[model samples]
Target chain A: MYFGPPGNTLVIVVSPPPDRPGLPARRVTIADIARAAGVSIAVVSYAVNGRPGVSAATRERVLRIAEEYRWQPSAAARSMHTGPRAVGLVVSTAAGGVSSASSFLDLVTAIQDVFGKHGYALLLKVVESVDAAVATYRTWWAERRFDVMIVTDVLSQDPRVEALRALRAPAVVVGAPAAAQGLTSVHLDDAEAFGRVASYLIGLGHRDVAVVTGQPELHRTQVRVAALARMLKDAGGSLLRMTTDAGPEEAAAATRQLLTSPVPPSVIVYDSDQMALAALDVARRLGVEVPWDLSILAASDSALCRLSTPALTALPSPLRELGTAVGDAVLAVLNGQSATSHVVPVGGLAIRGSTGPLARRTKQ
Target chain B: MYFGPPGNTLVIVVSPPPDRPGLPARRVTIADIARAAGVSIAVVSYAVNGRPGVSAATRERVLRIAEEYRWQPSAAARSMHTGPRAVGLVVSTAAGGVSSASSFLDLVTAIQDVFGKHGYALLLKVVESVDAAVATYRTWWAERRFDVMIVTDVLSQDPRVEALRALRAPAVVVGAPAAAQGLTSVHLDDAEAFGRVASYLIGLGHRDVAVVTGQPELHRTQVRVAALARMLKDAGGSLLRMTTDAGPEEAAAATRQLLTSPVPPSVIVYDSDQMALAALDVARRLGVEVPWDLSILAASDSALCRLSTPALTALPSPLRELGTAVGDAVLAVLNGQSATSHVVPVGGLAIRGSTGPLARRTKQ
Candidate 1:
């Protein structure tokens, strides 16, 4: 049995189980009893505690199922009555991605600061993959280690969201709105931000634009690609997109390929400050003058962007604000407020020496 | 009362407290009772739990004091008996410091990987100052949130070490050997790394060397400065040192100042990869061609150092190995081993395009 939002709840009914006189092989969870009883977990809870909610027959059936299964509330379940006063965040990325994730650290610091003031500690875990992250969340949730969880790097079909939903854990996703999948989220207006970037580049007379971005599967990457492609097509220009693992080597290789192509892009944008910096290095190595023969821009800004040679043009990520918003969303969920999504506004583009007007071809 | 290593212990004596018949004003901790009873925390634990290690009279005295103070073991303390199976790490730095700390993130990822395999999660906190870090540790320790703590960015006179000792918490300091201050630590040989840098610069026929480093009060900074000064003095060369808050702007300003100086050094070394990259930008802006008119090196290496224009010469920080060593030290301490320090060997300098032979002056 499953529980949905209040007033619009959906419950699945299961066939009655056969009577088994033998003891169970392992400790049975409330979820297990709920499944066997063909009722929602809340109904099982009400039945076991003798609360006045379900009908007498239904309550008896739930209680009998629980007894047959030898179900006992876990220490974690019992402790939930007294909150743990902590939040869990798992960053599922490769080891290389960790070092290049300066904005991520900034977001963490902001979230920690807000949560700390509210007497909640952030329990952080960094894993290699989303599947590992889901496993971690399960262990943490089963232990009742935290009152809420903050989910990041939301994919198109994230398993973490489903896992959290199954456990009915309070959670807030931090990613694009479309990727939240009905879960509460604090996200950036990626479509609007990408549209602004496209307008800015096109307004600067760039016709052939190229974007070197992270994995194509990431929701944000897909959103940005679609937005840029739409705007470029409307303007009768072509958009070329290349994907990398968000590593400097991969970004550099992509940049090299783009630069050596038959019809090289006049303006190239990168998904991260590190990737943009890598593109800069590749351009310098190839003797291509930045903002002259080629223009470069970064999707995210950092100290690296500000201090790099020629100073990269970038769209500054409002990580601190986004973190605070996520913290607020977590607090609201913990406070029993209905889950709602928030969109934090992003700042405008920071124009620097790396980007310039597309110059006319001398030979043509 | 105090406890040292198992064999050679020092216990302080305190006068008996006045009898209090009323309930306490606030919840009393075991430490308070231990202080009034003039016994170590271990003795208090044994007395409270009816263990046989302490004398009957001492146990009676301890119990009487505990009762008078209305002392009850904290939930955290009770949970400690069952083991929380988690480790704590606090990165106390300013907000800007968090973004520039890529190597710190690398170290965290490596540590997390090791601890995760051991079924231990890392509880991380980033604060603005060491005092705040100490306060955070106190809160975490009082709650018994983690079984062990990993202390980073150790100062010359660190209060955290003393605080951890007072709490009797298992901990491992990650910094210079001198900074550990009798605590268990995993350290890199800063003196040897600085000596190598000094030798390398002098070998390149550079008579004047400049070092741009973090706050002078930092233990690692002082160690590097002293070692570099000693090496330069022995070689009949002069050394110039400047300190910054480890921000890119300050580093760039220092670089600009060094380049415009009447007798600017031929080789300038930066304490971090970010600072070196900032200096590279500054040198370019000032028309000081890298490795031709000026040479640059970084004390720590990262992908930034490798991909920067001219490719900064650096000493690769073995952060992964150091993190693993720290993890091992943490496990050893948790397993009741005596506090013993471990020194991880540093790798040799990675000479890149930034450093070269000092060119003869054309107009000097």
Candidate 2:
């Protein structure tokens, strides 16, 4: 196979013919890649063949360029990626509480639908902490555990972005990391969604509202809290906030504390359906009628929302669509495409039985 | 490595002394396995070294024998097992709907807790159908996709048990597959628990009872149905049963159908807390007072049980403990030990507001 940069033109013998019949048509040629990437044929040949004459950065750019043009490596080159046909979803234990959240399940199903068709099995890992999650990613990369990974619960200033990029790992971040830093990302617009939900509540004559958020450190929670604060400020409503581990007991205890205060808020907003349900339980226990004495709203949509007594009003997320977008990003990254970002928009608030105007009407 | 058998003595020169220091202690010799298996040293050596003369069946038997006695392979041999550090949990799409069930979340946490500590990521797959699930297992085995797998929603005649067993895949069944057929299993006793719950309800002076089950095709459902039938017969009461997809809409419709019947059940047993909550909603909408006009029981336990307006009575499955047992079983299987089973016992029922003494004093 002869490859060279002749003057300003890159020259190459596209396929060195000792084809021994019909074994090379499926393979993308170096000349084809070089033309697509607009680089010298020689550089494309080196990148394709795993020769280190070119810089790693240049090689990566060339590979992404090749993938962008939908190039398929030949039998010889495909061998380099012939380990297990698996992708992974790695989560932190802190995010485990959301496992029962219906949106997560819907997203998981959607992701499996796309990846399964492409023959990539989903490997899910829930690590004890963010550090453990990072370590797991590094170990998996070193051991070639998966062809690609989907990182959930991304942090505001994610260290994983640079860490994974340094290794050129193929991964898609769910819930946009604050500083994406070249990592492929697929996430919902949490700030916009939270503002929208808050506005809906504020429009309902709710003031002196209490926001029950999940853990303070979670990137999504912090983002939502900030968005809520801004929206509430605009509506001239003051806010009381409580942060919890998002467990049933903790959420209930927090709800209890909020309701039993000297001057309790009339409306309570929750980060999870479970927390809102806990609030509902608190209402029943304390003789506070839902939507009458206290109105409730869920920041996240879930089956729990619909099943509750006065089904919760929630910000409906198009989770399945987001999952498909994540799947696409993951597949693109796995195919060596340049990292990209996607913003999956949320649906408008689902108005259920849990929310109403604060005006009291006399019983007929 | 020469190995020989004499009468009762199996002599094995397990490692040809390339100690280079303190490495031998970490490596178990072929002789150590031969004596433990009570087999000839030559067979042990053949099994350990992957010699072609030994049969595949014989090799598997020898490997299990080696693991039985705690034979740790050396770094040289361990390299063969150095691929993905991952496990998998394969569930059906029908079961995927149950992802919101608090019990499922608990099990997921437990599985991650166990597997994460040992560095095995959980690969979760929700397939389109039973056939797809089987295909996934076969493909995973062909591609060596996982180090271990936990098969949930085991069926009456589970094809996966035999198929995976044929490949000698390391898997632990969440519920006992009717035909375990050499596969490792860990399950809760569905029938016994159902009988106990039935007895409790019968003791509460209920005669006309309704038992709502999840997908009736599931083995656990069949077992529980059979048990409930027996217990109800023993108590001289007939049952009004309904099997739905266990969704909120379907469950609510079913509850409405049962409640509005000419002879409505005095007590209702639900397969899940969500269904029971839906039943609760139906009761409220119909103006039937709980505990006075009807009683409810949730066969599956979850936080939903506690958070409902009238908290549900439920059977608690210690999911974390079960997960630990599964992890231990997976570790055991990966270590090539003889296949084993563990029965995770359920705790006494969590009695709550949803259930109460049937009012024969008023209704009759």
Candidate 3:
């Protein structure tokens, strides 16, 4: 190949044929013409690509230069003309390296199942701290790696929601959009879950009750606690205790303190089924009989909860369903369609041997 | 821009263009050169790209074409010339969307932590059925989306190991790779965990013992059961009863049946801290006294286990550390470095008040 100043450009004899016999391939690109014409690159782009702003004479000149070079972009380049096909999912988990709730895990599976069916593969990146979560959103937006992002375990006034808005990026939150204003959100009716459990305990004739929950700072926990308090007040009874655990150990310690209190409630309610089991152990250690001396209720029930001694009275909450619903809402928002805040109803209360009419009190 | 037969090649004229700029736009691509080169596109690609076999003169001609067009692929494409930077983790859970063990969850978090620190993001995809798991792996491979893959909760003679081999993708598994043949793997010393628990119980003067575990098919469970069998045999007493729970309900039901048997074991060793609580509950319901009729041993201790009634006896297992170690191994393997299979030692047995010397029997 040979090149020189424009009009007198010389074409030299090339060597060595491709190994493949009888196959002639032709793929050209605009860059070739720009070099041949000694013109600015964008002028070449405007001339051959037919994009606007270049004069017809200039466009014609650029095409003539490109023709002399016989340049074309490869098939791969032609395909690039189409829109980006890959969809991106930015999975944000709560900080502290905590695994998401069981229900959220299930929901993730369901959402993945649905997305996979639609030929979209989910891409996950764990967002450790709130700051890191914000950074991830910013990075993903600037790079445009994903078509949509799903933020999960949203907090009241999640900073990420604002980050997404600032970038004008599409996002769906998997918890109440407490501070997200117009962002799409999905979550379970925690108040209802709380009200049901409180009502069930009251129906069983338990006036004194205790509630143990996870981190009080979690929005859902606050909602449930408030609901429990309101229900107890309306029922002409008062909650004996409300404690929270950052994790299982804290839950167990709370159980011990609550159970051994001078005036322990006859029944205990746990925010998570796992914590409820801890409470059961505390009761057993104290020689307190379940359903006989102390009844137990689980706001969130699972196989583990149901199988606890005396079979706990529980709220039938489906976590997997909630996760999938959030995922669906995210997809809708990303697709430029407005989606309503999704509220998955918790299942009705599950009554088991864990609850019995208050043991008849004997006159002292 | 204009194009014609070889000699009447394309030309691009930059009119009022070189100095005019707003935000200095990116360059155009080879496709623009093709349109200018006039010959059925391939001619331009054949000429300017100089990809060989284009006659010398034709190659020179194509170069002239590109020079006229002035196009180039995006900088993003240039950076991607090496490959994608992320790794994919396909977490396989048990049937019914159940997550892997808590230890595994910790490991995942740890792995993510380490990987993120090293400038690589971990991509998590949860697969339920084994078939779906394999399919997801194949899809990811076909797309070349991940640099390396991590498969967890390895089954006995898992098909994924073999499938991964066929794919020849770099991967680090979280179980014994011996069965996996050529694939690299990291394994936990299950036998050690069980041995520690068994020895703890034997030291407590308990000859009769029961074990509760998860699905028997799990490789770790089998290892624990085998270790328990061998150790118990040495003590002149073999395992009295060993049961598995597909979930918590089955575990509780099994515990109920075990305790209600004609002769219940004096001590129960639980596979998980969660299951141990269930065993404790069974003892309480049967009116059995701890340390007197029942001594409980929690095999895997978490913070939750320590806070259980009697502050349960448990094996000090560090899941987060193991997870981080595995994650490092994955990154190493992906980076073309050799990673040895590491077996992190389990922490020593933490004996709490849950177990005590066996009750002395008086002659009738």
Candidate 4:
């Protein structure tokens, strides 16, 4: 199949019109329905679309004609007017390598569910860098190939937000208030989630707490770290240690060291469930009994956390709800309406085997 | 941003051109370049594309003219006549729930990497089901949105093969030898990989071994499972147990039961890294020391396996090379060439902290 100029009319020339008594039929077209209904092409289009000017009787008549002809309107034709019924999720990196993180993998899966339910195809664009992400969005806009764009891993003062503003494109940012307010935003109440985790540990009579996180530059990580600090201060307890690793390997290395330290904290919390899994490994490696000598908590939930030996205590992020909110915002933005930013709080801290009472903090 | 027939182009008619200096500029046209080169628009096209019938000197002159005018040929315009420089990747299902069981996510990411390097944008489509996959492919073919198509998740007597053959569409299959010779295929030495792993275990004096796998319906899983059974028989030993689970949850549950059995196997092999993680969780819960009471081997390499406690032994799938092979095959089929079926062998096994010699099987 070759793509050429728009001048080419797609005319399917059948061979001799199938000169048999019961031959297979050809493709049904809008013109066939129009002719059968004794209506003009414009009238048929209006009736099919349920435009106000079309009378109810005429609309029913056109529908009856279309059913008789077994005609289906082309998806392309419909999309041309309605924009592509697809959400463009331009992830800002390739799938492999150390720098890339799968923290958003669950979110991607959830978003696909919401979009698919709404008949919107999810298009993945692997933008090698931030600049590439902006360029892909521009290209998508020019080609009219996406109805909405969902942004993740939002950096402070992201260029994509600026680009979207310039193009007046429909977009939803899974990010913080300042950068996300102009567009629509959806995220967990991260500050509250972290505060609760810290408070839970304090309630268990633990004074020494160490926190491990993903990339320190991430916006969500910053919020979580600050919340932990605040919670400790309010409880008249000081943070024993706070560490930020560059990647998964570094996170694992730090976790091993923290557990093996002579003065290891009684409780350890991570910015992600994946990181929390690393802590479990470190504890087992050092022969330090989890909950017996150390406790682990993370900011998000997944199957990994659920299936862990001590089903991890985590703040359950509402993945499906976040995805649906993004979808709703996209539709609103695309219709030239203001989509107000929303914070979908992931309430309730789930306690699992990973946590236990202070365990005589003297284990340190 | 609002859709709906574009609203008559929204032409905000400006009064002539604003009398301002350096008001940026509009995109240069083919006509301007043609005029500058003292040639026709057809000549410019021929020179830009290096087509025959254009003298070298004339081509150079036209290029110089185009450079002076900054006349970039539009991608949409260039796509005409040339096949679409994009491939449609129809993932059989969205990355949610049960679909993640098959290695579709990995395959898609790998294939995208290969295609992206070649300047081909992948038009991703998530088919709701197997039948939907076929329908989506048919529509994509009819619409001419892609130059080549990739077919994965090969099933017995697959209908996709027949559909592609009927359309004579250039395609590649990521599976076993199918009945149709018209399509190119790329498969891993799954049986060989499994055989190597089994032989390694047997050499380590592990007599009692068990295999846990993902969905058995997939052709690749079937191959690996069969290979394990055969290799054990050749070693004068038998597979102590064989089981299939739906996903990580079921795999974790299965692992718990298997490890708790009175006559537990000395070693366990998993079909995927995720499942291997589940096995690890189960072993930890049952207090069965890894590489001690039980050794673990994962079929696929991922961060989970590498970072887990007692780093898992696994075979890297040679993802980059596999991607490259798929890319090359797609290009070959598109060029009307009969590409040979390519089977890339898996890389050597990466033995880590997981596998070890079996404890002497003394009377218990």
Which structure among the candidates has the greatest TM-score?
A: 1
What's the lDDT for residue A75 in model 3? 21
Interface RMSD of 3: 9.1
Q: Model 1's DockQ?
A: 0.11
Query: What overall lDDT, based on C-alpha atoms, would model 2 receive against the true structure?
Result: 0.72
Show the lowest summed lDDT stretch of 10 residues, model 2 chain A: A19-28
lDDT of 1 at A178: 71
> DockQ of candidates 1 onward, in order?
0.11, 0.12, 0.15, 0.21
Return whichever of 1 and 3 wins on DockQ: 3
TM-score of model 3 (first chain only)? 0.72
Tens digit of per-residue lDDT, candidate 3, span A203-315: 88878878787655566766777888899899888876555544666777887888778877777788766677677767777787877888888776777676566677888
Tens-place lDDT digits, model 4, residues B107-132: 55567776666656676665556677
Clashing residue pairs in candidate 1, if any?
A: none
Worst 10 residues of 1 chain A by lDDT: A4-13
Report the lDDT tens digits of candidate 1 across residue range A1-364: 2342333223333332343333233234576667666667888888888888777777777777765654555333433356567789887774134534666666777887777887777788877888888888766754556778898877777788887765567889887667877778898877788899889888998989999988776767788889999999999888999988887778899999999988899999898888898899999999888988899999888777898888999987898898888878887888878778899877898999999988835327
- Model 4, residue B219: distance off in Å is 0.8
Query: Candidate 4 clashing pairs?
Result: A3-B80, A3-B81, A4-B80, A4-B81
lDDT of 3 by residue, B131-217 (tens): 777887766655445677887767777787777766666888777656445676787787787887777778877777788777666
- List residue ranges in candidate 4 displaced over 4 A: A1-84, A94-106, A112-119, A239-247, A260-263, A360-364, B1-85, B93-110, B117-119, B143-145, B159-163, B166-169, B179-182, B240-243, B260-263, B360-364
Better of 2 and 3 by lDDT: 2
Going through the candidates in order, what fraction of the true interface contacts does each contain?
Answer: 0.28, 0.24, 0.28, 0.17
For candidate 4, give the lDDT. 0.69
Kindly list the per-residue Cα lDDT of model 4 for residues A25-127, writing each as its tens digit: 4344576666556666777788888777666766777787666544556555565455456677777642121232343444554666555656566667665
